[model samples]
Target: MKVLGMLYGMAVGDALGMPSELWSREKVKSYFGDITEFLDGPKENDVACNFTKGQFTDDTTQALLILDSLIENDFIPSEKLIAEKLIEWAVRTDAFENNILGPSSKAALLAIKEGENADILTRKALTNGAAMRIAPIGALFSTAQNKELSEYVFEVSRATHTSDVSIGGAAMIAYAVSASIEDKSWEQIIEGALNIYELASKKGAETFTASIPERLKLGIEFADLYQDDEETFTQKIYDVIGCGTMTSESVPAALAIAYYAKDPNRCALICANIGGDTDTIGAMATAICGAKYGYDAIRKDWIDTIDSENSVDLKNYAHFIELHKPQFKGV
Candidate 1:
């Protein structure tokens, strides 16, 4: 149930955000012309993620595979397991079989194939790829919330995302989700993550808080730029956030959505609208909000629209694995 809550919530966010993945706020207003309720694909966007209307992309797929690997291994993950499971899941799905791996992940996997040191290999790459697939660490370690757990989650990320910001972002999100699962308030989760970030390397608590409003303004401003031309919404925000590469832009952009959106669905929709790494930010926000609010909080219609073969199976699989989780035995 805990697993389903996280995975399903993530897919809902991914699918919801897919339509307006790169649109700015004003562009979204112009595109949807309203957007009060759940809407379909973003108009004039020729991207594949948005091509299928309300659908999920790699973020949810990688995350679901991560959860599957952890559950299959009894919550203990290693570099080899992660690589193998990712390739396996991708090949089975036909999405990644056509050679569609994310840039950082592709590099990391190639390094693994060459038998390079996992630590050194991870440090060499600091893409959002690591943070993109890190939601399961939060769910798996939801029970262990102290500094010890924080350290373990950091180590879990270090195996793949060794850069300061990359690892810090993953750790922060994991801590927030785990803390939220424990029923902490939104402020509590954010502050807890801020405290962790402050203690770990260059990521400061004040920096996190200060970045929020700034990023939100950027998103809103980028959105406003498209008031005249909805067609340029994706490109304009992509220019602002530059969805091409780097975990810094992707992680923080995703965090911005969660920070502004307190509600589960709202967070998904808002993050999706922020653009550039739309699926990633949307997926991350969904994981955080889902962990906080549970599966019951996400709207049913959004859940229904997800790509069933990939999305629904993952949710069911995650839920089945959650049955043996000791913390959830009674609840």
Candidate 2:
């Protein structure tokens, strides 16, 4: 149930935040007035305008690509399989034509289509594209298997985003989810994520991007400082931590907001309204939230809506994950 909870939570968050993606925090507030329910994307926001209510954006789609690849590979993370799955999804969904794909992923996949090596092509591609679709990596690896987890993350994420910040942010989210699946409290998950971030950061090629670990620390501080002022917490996270496409900003913002919300549903709500890259942030954060709380914590109506509205069967993904989980290569 918990394994499925992680997937459902990611989908829920993605849909919850779909309409608000790419909008600034101020614009989100001015236009939507803090998202409480799923709404269709308005014509004003170019990135989100095409999506309808209860529809998840590319974040969830890409996450499922990873899961599908893993399930087919007997739960082993294969870079080649991941790349192939991504290309298939992009073409099938018209991701490139629709402008739904993230910038870094689009560039890398395009290079791959031209027979260029994705590893080299993604050398400087630093964005949350890797982190946004990384929930499965967390659920696949255990907290103690940091070495294996980092290797798997690098292999999968480097196909699209190769920078230290990008890979590390993806690992950070995965590590937090691993901790959550182990029933760790949000505090423990935060600590575990930071520790793994340093290890994972050293694996990828260094880039000019800001350090995800350092920004994550600041996010924690921001979370603490805003405890007495819950009303301004989202705004503070938006300004200081940011909710941008950069791996450094969105991943840490997701982690901090997840910790602050302390519940899957609340995490979805708070992140949905946080503006810039909201769907990615929400997907990442809420997945971690669900790992801790499991199925019972989520509302039944939300589950039914996500099942009916989305294309993928979240339960089938979860079932496959659970069935093959014993064969996970992370350990």
Candidate 3:
């Protein structure tokens, strides 16, 4: 049930924030005020303007590709297979030229299409695309040891985002989601995520690593302040940590918000209201919160809305993850 929550939570957050992605905090406030429900992307939104209310964007769509690839390959998709599926999805969904794909993913996919090695092409690319689609990997491998989990995170992320920064962001989200699914305490989850981030930082991009611990600590501090004055809290987050698409900024922001909110709906709202990269941040935060609180934690209305709008089956993805979970040899 919680697994279902994580999957649906991703879509719910993605849909709720779709309209606001790339908007500035001031612009978002001027327009939507505060996103409490699904809304169509603004006419000015170049990428998402074509989407209807309650329709998820590339975040969930790409995630579903990862989910399908994982299930079809029995939990371990090679880089080529993952690249093929991503390209296939882009073409099939007409995202190839729709300005829908992220810069890093678009470049990597193009490189793959041109016969470059997926891993080599993405080695320098760093974006939230990998992290946005990483919840399923976390949920499916919740019980694996941290070392094993980190390895899997690397393998999955390297298919399209090879930067240590990007991989670290994805690993942090993955470990947090996994820990939440295992019902670990919030402290434990945070610590586990930090540990994964530390390890991942050692190998890849070194840009964001040094500041993560401080950012996370700041998030906790702000969470305490959030209860006193919501407006000030939001402003503080915007001014300090940011809500942009950079893996460093958005990933930590998502973790902080999820840690602060601890509830799926509130997490989604916080991410949605923060502006840039709203859908991706909302998806990451709400997925972790959903893992914590279960599917029932999400608003019934939101679930119904997403179900009516999107074509993919959330439960089917969850079921496939469950069915394809790794079988440990000497557990």
Identify the superior model by lDDT, candidate 2 or candidate 3.
2
lDDT tens string, model 1, 63-166? 76666666686666565676777656655655433334665566666566566755565665556676776776666555344455455545455545665656
Worst 10 residues of 1 by lDDT: 204-213
| lDDT assessment of candidate 2 | 0.86
The candidate that achieves the highest TM-score relative to the unseen native structure: 2
Ranking by TM-score: 2, 3, 1
Output the lDDT of residue 126, model 3. Answer: 64
Candidate order, lDDT descending: 2, 3, 1
Candidate 2: pairs in clash = none
Question: What TM-score would candidate 2 get against the native?
Answer: 0.96
lDDT of 3 by residue, 1-331 (tens): 9889999889998988899998899999999887888998889888779899999999988888876776777676677788889999888877879889988898889878888765565776667888898887888665457676667777776767877788777889989988999999988988888888877655564443436667777876887777667677777777788788878778888888888888899888888888889999999999999998999999999999999999988988888777666573211
Residue-by-residue lDDT tens digits, candidate 2, 15-82: 99999888887888999887888889899988888888888989999989888887887776787888
> What residue runs in model 2 are displaced by over 4 Å at the alpha carbon?
none
RMSD of each: 6.3, 1.4, 2.1
In model 1, pairs of residues that clash are 22-275, 24-223, 25-223
| Whole-model Cα lDDT of every candidate shown, in order | 0.60, 0.86, 0.82
Off by over 4 Å in 1: 1-3, 19-51, 91-99, 114-121, 142-144, 198-245, 307-311, 327-331
